[model samples]
Target: MTEDFVNGAAVQALLDRASGLDAEGGDGRLKAIVRELAEAVMRTIVRHDVSESEFWAAIQYFQEGAAEFGLIVPGVGLEHFMDLLMDARDAEAGRTGGTPRTIEGPLYVAGAPLVEGDVNLSDDPDDTGTLYMSGVIRGPGGEPVEGAILHVWHANSQGWYSHFDPTGEQTPFNNRRRIRIGSDGRYSFHSKMPNGYSVPPGGATDRLMRALGRHGNRPAHVHFFVEAPGYRTLTTQINFGDDPFAADDFAFATREGLLPVPNRQGDAATIVFDFELQKAGASTEEGFSLRARAAV
Candidate 1:
């Protein structure tokens, strides 16, 4: 009798049986991906000799963290990974010369007050360090992109985002707004410099970070989602150049050419960052998934 070999080859063969109905109308990609991932996971488990107890514990850990899944993606770099994949595809297809796109994280709300060229975003009375940030939205060749919408939001000094915090509901949209680009493609806003963010202490995210010897902190940064006619929507963030975690962001989202040094002008610190957008080419509908959109 042959000795049993419990490596992934045997497990994968067993799993592949479920993919037998290849002619069932659907493209075979679904079963193919499932089989591939299942095999890889089995390999990792066997290679590491993960015990059944450890696997079940991991499952329970994930279940507990499901509510805060949005926060975990950026923390673990999945959000950034997706952005990199999109960027690579765009570059391979000849899409270039746009402000680098970054992760959107999970806190974006659809309806924000639309303001004109410039407005004050911070509502906290104690926020004494004002930030006067402005920028221009232009096309690939620097042509003005009038009427572009800049949906912006950022964490407050205490690292809590408006609307997500319990008290934040009282002033639902504070520190978050949608600004329309002016005729000259200029948009500006005054707010306090947002402080950095960290994972909830003692939560599922924190547990994993601790196990991996990693810290769950993001550098101080602001989020922007720019959309306009004839342009691909741009999602990106700008980080403070001097933040200790600016280069060591847990999300791995910090990008070169995006870190801006704040210049002090009297009471306010100003950072200028202009955005250049790529022209919309063929529709990116092929790789689009509604479920994935809902996840973000």
Candidate 2:
């Protein structure tokens, strides 16, 4: 009972701080979310009038659960959270340009191998899927940004990433590639398209979902992280040409504008994606680059 009362004080302190907030620094919108989270935490904590020791034991899962997650997927959630807020913030400030930013999964590791043009991503001898991704990276004027960098990667048939998949041979950047945008902001690569994946079978997300009797599955898609100087970075994906589960993506990562038209062929073929970005400061930074960003 004493412990519960102390927890109540903690809750009130949080509420007090959150309720008195500013839009820019204090973020009034965050107060409601804090309230909801506080209530949830209280619900789990106040259930049995447990002893102080028991309460600590119950709270241990927060750290354990977090440690179970990888670096990539966690950022996906953060990306989504930021995207929602930034969209409103940008609109309020009248900043615009480029396709809307989306989440970048934790699977994105830096320092991929660079190449001039086409990349053969399928490493398995038995694997025979071909996909060609081409595009122009453009600036605010809708003009091409020459020498932009396009880094790409995708899962194998088993829906596993290169660094994580145990079934595949131990090779670094197996399904990854980096391409330089040509004089006209044009870039292209060749690889086997990706398939969708389900959540980790028995983690906190899945444990909660299973207790709530929900299914955990995500739709098929390929991932990309494109970078350029004087422009923000673009971390997005393209769903399989005709994935039935695209709209109902388990992760709910699929967006209408995020989907691209895929051109499949028995023979080698290609499709073009026109990428664009607004001038920095003139618009909110959408696709950030380190080489120039650090210089600024």
Candidate maximizing lDDT: 1
- Candidate 2, 1-296: lDDT as tens digits: 43366357676676556555323456666777876676666665666566789777646755667744542243235446666787789789897767766655656656667777656766554254666777778888888887688877777656777776767563667677677767788776777656677767776667655665665666667777766777767767766546777776645567657777677677433567777765566334544433211000
Worst 10 residues of 1 by lDDT: 287-296
Whole-model lDDT per candidate: 0.78, 0.64
Deviating ranges (above 4 Å) for candidate 2: 1-63, 70-79, 123-126, 168-170, 266-271, 282-296
Residue 192 displacement in candidate 1 (angstroms): 2.9
Give each model a TM-score: 0.89, 0.73
Q: Count backbone clashes in candidate 2.
A: 8
Model 2 residue 257 lDDT score? 71
TM for candidate 1 is 0.89
> Which residue segments of model 1 deviate by more than 4 Å?
1-10, 17-27, 167-170, 265-267, 283-296
Model 2 TM-score, 2 decimals: 0.73
Model 2, position 21, has a per-residue lDDT of 36
